[model samples]
Target: MASKLTGTVALVTGASSGIGVDAARQLAEQGAAVALVARRKERLETLAAEITEAGGTALAVEADITDRDQAEAAVRQTVERFGRLDILVNNAGLMLLGPVVGADPREWERMIAVNVQGLLHTTHAALPHLLKAAEEGPRQVADIVNISSIAGRQAWENYGVYNLTKFGVNGFTESLRQELAGRHVRVGVLEPGAVDTELGSHNNATIHAEMLDPFNAQHERLVPADIADGITYMVTRPRRTAIAELWVMPTDQA
Candidate 1:
């Protein structure tokens, strides 16, 4: 039997680690040619080799999605190599947790750059190719899966700017879903609660000991593959079905 994505192509950002790495692997396992994008060239190359050894086509495109030129170039490279793009997973993001008062504005800027502006740049570049793929490719559909967080739905005290970025992601996803519904481009947001990824390690030591450490000790966290499963499910749905917004949380998370 053939796989669900035998003729499709997918581009995954932040593919150097965690959810992005697993998402790329799962998509390739389902037979989609995958382009892995990240700043860590060595990690991306290793992953590409691993996928290729497993008999799945993969390409490593070193890029920082925060830069508009690099983001667009990554999309162009994917299409150039794979012929067309049927799915785009915007998985690159930053999480710097702290109170709004006396917080580092630079950290907030970084979060906004990677979380909000990065998503926009890649989406803008990939939209045309995805639109074309939806109209003419074998699947006759295209998908944009933005990896958000549970923070998008609820505001936590130390998660102000991170919350803002994710909330923005949810809002943008909804608007795009509506606009592209008629065009066969399905835009969806996947919000995962407290995953055991490097996302939490970026915080300052104070934040970690005071907030993150306790949270981890209390609640069972999710794995990268868990969120990757959600991503795969969203993109593989039949053309008539659209998973607009999916919230995947650990059972222990409230």
Candidate 2:
């Protein structure tokens, strides 16, 4: 059988580890030329080597998505190397949750920059290529998957800024989907809940300790591959199908 994504090109931001890394690998396994973008050169290089060694096309792009120039460069490099861009996964994000009243203002700014602005920068740069790729490509369709959080859908006391950024991502993804629907460019959002990743590492010690209570109580914490599975399903669909919004949470999660 022909590979689902044969002859396609995909760019995944924050692909050094976690969900982004897994998604890139899964896409490559389906036959897309994968560009892995992240700030950690060593990690990106290692992952790229693994993918290439496994008979998949892979490129390591060291970039900070928060930097507009770097973000744009990553997308340009993908097109320059692969000749077209079929998938853009805006997976780079920051989540630092704490009480709104005493939370460091800097943390809020950082979340906004990485979670919101970074997505905008990458999407803005990749839009033209994605639209063009949809015109004529292996699948005749292109996809942009923005990684959001369950917090985007609901508000909690201490997660004010993180929720704000994710909510912005949801709105942005929906608006872009509407704008690009006629063009055959599918835009979607993947919202995951309490995944076992480094997302919580940025939280302050106090907040971390506070989070441990509920986090530990939940026996079934989600793995990175769980989120990757949802993403893979989204992009691997036939050109005629579009999964606009996907919410994935551990079955035990409530």
Candidate 3:
């Protein structure tokens, strides 16, 4: 009775809550030892405890992915603990909604740092390990799942800069997918639309209100588990399969 991800090691960023937590849990359930990386030590510890209680191996690694040294260290710790890296779920991101004219530049900066820069830092640090795992591991394949948003596919009125960061994710994923496809390191992007999470809480009152407008909340949205299921599916596929791009928008979305 071998598990799907037996002997695999996965690192999930933004793992303190929301999609990252769920994805990490699911990966662990499938028998991959998980490294939970995030700035929130308390939350990561709680999550790691729960996974350990459930008989899954998990390590809480506190690091801010926005910092290059911290991001690299996080990767190093995972490899040091697990011996190899098989899956990387780059799920950390921030979203701030406001018109470009009246928006605070700081909000835009935060989104760019977490969504674009943080993702780049982690991916850059994990590439060599992932390639090695693909070359020589039980699975003989590796996965990098970049969590993008629907905004990456199209632009919205008040989401200009957020759009920029997510669109950059799409481009980076595509380019990396081509480069790594030859090495059996599968690179993919998961685009989620209107997921049920606290992704908008960081915005100011007005911007937050605008983000929660009636039209946006009227329909059922995806949950963290929903995206987690998708991530699990993407990573569990056999070496012959590579899910290069996945659009996981709600059915109500156009």
RMSD of each: 0.6, 1.0, 1.0
User: Residue by residue across 65-179, what tens digits does model 2's lDDT show?
Assistant: 8999999999999999989999999999888877888667988889999999999999999999999889987788999999998998998988898899999999999999999
In model 3, which range of ten residues has the least summed lDDT? 208-217
lDDT of each: 0.96, 0.91, 0.93
Q: Give stretches of model 3 more than 4 Å off.
A: none
Q: Judge candidate 1 at residue 202 and give its lDDT.
A: 85
Local accuracy of candidate 3 as per-residue lDDT tens digits, 74-152: 9999999999999999999999887899777988888999999999999999999999999998999999999999999
Please report how far candidate 2 places residue 195 from its true position, in Å. Answer: 0.7
User: Which regions of candidate 2 fall more than 4 Å away from where they truly are?
Assistant: none
Q: What range of 10 consecutive residues in model 1 has the weakest lDDT sum?
A: 196-205
- What TM-score does structure 1 among the candidates reach? 0.99
- Against the true structure, whose TM-score is highest? 1
TM per prediction: 0.99, 0.98, 0.98
Candidate 1: segments with Cα more than 4 A from true spot: none
Positional deviation of residue 205's Cα in model 3 after best superposition, in angstroms: 1.6
Best by lDDT: 1
Rank order by lDDT, top first? 1, 3, 2
Q: What's the residue-level lDDT of 227 in candidate 3?
A: 96
**Model 1, residue 242: C-alpha shift (Å):** 0.4
